[model samples]
Target: MQPRKDNAGFSIIELMISLAVLVIIAGMATANWQGTIERHQARQTKQELRTLFQVARHTAINRRQMTTFCPLDAANACTNDWDQPISVFIDPGSLKVLAQPDYLIRTFKAMPNGTLIASHSGPQERRYFQFNPDGTVHGTIGNLTWCPDSLMAERGVHVIVNFGGRIRWGKDRSGDGVVEKASGQPISCA
Candidate 1:
């Protein structure tokens, strides 16, 4: 009798188990990918804010012009999503409204994943934080808080651009000014 050959491959049951394992792996991979994207989006928002802050400060100092940073709304409020739009402009020499984009330095739209909201320490109507040619900002301690919609998050980000236009980011303890602290991030003018 000829030696019987055992044609063996993955049995149906073994194939099913392998498929299940693969599905689980794929699911986990997808979740991880989504998380990475979300975190990236958040970081991108903060980086953008930092960039704008530095650019505005430098432009004011270099151009010897008053650069203004403000929320898009005239009310100076960011009630929409976490990603809010903002405007930056240089004041016309005449001190009138920015001459229809002539003085517009940069216009930024918030990312969908993150919102940029503003809350002033003083008056509500005033939005613009004008920085003089000397890099001195003209505002009190105004606070802008950025956080995810979920409260379960342990840490949130805050941008405190003192009236002097000195920008720093840190944690927002109470989401208010009662007790805010910095996260030790390097925020330098140079």
Candidate 2:
């Protein structure tokens, strides 16, 4: 009888090549996953802000009292730093300060990783949104822009609050990957 040769296992070179390909694929997948996570964080931040605005407006109208949505400082006074923990509270006095803990309707935690900028129609920085009992904004219209730490500023989303207290989201309308404001100008984070 003729002797038979065994070829039951892969060569060392073949195994090494397969491992290299797997490593490359894993690297690509990791990059894609990171991008997806960043997008999700941005989207979540936008939605949370929108919900807070709506809640503040509705609360003001229903309770027949002024409602303020803002980030509070150590003194419980409103601050322009939107990255701080935000609160929706009944401000019957329009003092922009949280007097009693019972007056707080909701408190939103700060963003995990990002920069939040709130600006009025002009060059003024928006410190807070005060909704009148009639559900209209008390001051100038403004927008809240959230920029992810990993992405460009223009890639972030915008939550605009009109004078009527209506909330809307602004996105890239020109397909240029940059969000625009009401004037069709690209949003500048700097």
Candidate 3:
């Protein structure tokens, strides 16, 4: 212990241990960062949905015409699948997709992958939620739930509209500071 040797630098084992510790820390930080990213994406998607619905609702009120909200096909016809691109158009009192080109108001592209847009009438009949000229929802009052492909802890968001055409978000039933389905339950991927 008294003799001075050639102590130039750290030993190979010491260097490897230091590097291994750093890698572990990096891995943990990366995982956390990914979770944060997912949470942000979920929030943004929810906000987009809110804005779209509000626009559709307000359009009908201002124009004093039936406003139809539904997914549109390549031919611009209304499609039942909500996963496709959606658009708001003048209902023309027919409740069908308008034949006139100017009837088309706005179109939203398909949502990002790993996310889902679904609608249900009383939890069974899937239908489009239309707005009346008076701003009240046309006979279709239900929940439009948006969920990620993988239902992680972040869960999902629901834009709930009542018969009066009032739009509100699902409550934080889980009490996790994250809004979930309006049914007081966590959203399911299926």
Candidate 4:
């Protein structure tokens, strides 16, 4: 009788099964990672908008004056230029941020390829808004536009500041965070 020999290695079927399982696990991990990244971006974007709104409110209260956060065409008054960046400061009875020097109130870099469209009524608006000493947002002004550079592996974030000085973020066209709507409108102190 002839002796039979078997290879001391896994069969083709075993190799295929192992590869398939690894691929499945990898896919799941990728999906989870993507979700986490999106949520984080959304939160960050929300925070930035809130910070600006809060700062304006605090300025109005602390200085006992009205404040405005909006965009401009040139830098002047409290700002060195307009539409360049967001600004924050006191202007007579109005604390306005709308020029260079002043517009640099803060800075935030968007995630790669991620787009940020901010508007009081639309998503494609720019960074513009206002606040009163009584903690109310002015006009249909406050809007923020942002976009990521790409390669961030997530969805873009959006923020809006309505006439009530309420900053909100959102995934769709609706606002995010919280906007008091009726109760948030800016008001005079006297």
Top TM-score hit: 2
Best by lDDT: 2
**C-alpha RMSD (angstroms) for model 4:** 8.4
Cα shift from native, residue 15, model 1 (Å): 3.5
lDDT ranking, best first = 2, 3, 1, 4
Q: Write the per-residue lDDT of candidate 2 for residues 1-190, one digit (tens) a residue.
A: 9999999998999999999999999999998887787788887887788788889999999999999989999999998888899999999889999999999999999976788888763666788889999999997788888888865765588878788999888878888878887777777766
RMSD of each: 7.0, 2.9, 3.0, 8.4
Off by over 4 Å in 3: 1-3, 7-10, 122-127, 153-155, 176-178
lDDT of 1: 0.61
Better of 1 and 4 by TM-score: 1
Across 92-179, the per-residue lDDT of candidate 1 in tens digits comes to: 4524245455777887776455444555445553455567888887545555555444311322355777656678766544544222
Where does model 1 exceed 4 Å of error? 1-12, 71-84, 92-99, 120-128, 145-157, 171-190
Task: Give the Å shift of residue 38 in candidate 2.
Answer: 1.6
Off by over 4 Å in 2: 1-24, 120-124
Provide the global lDDT of candidate 3 against the true structure: 0.74
Greater-TM-score candidate between 3 and 4: 3
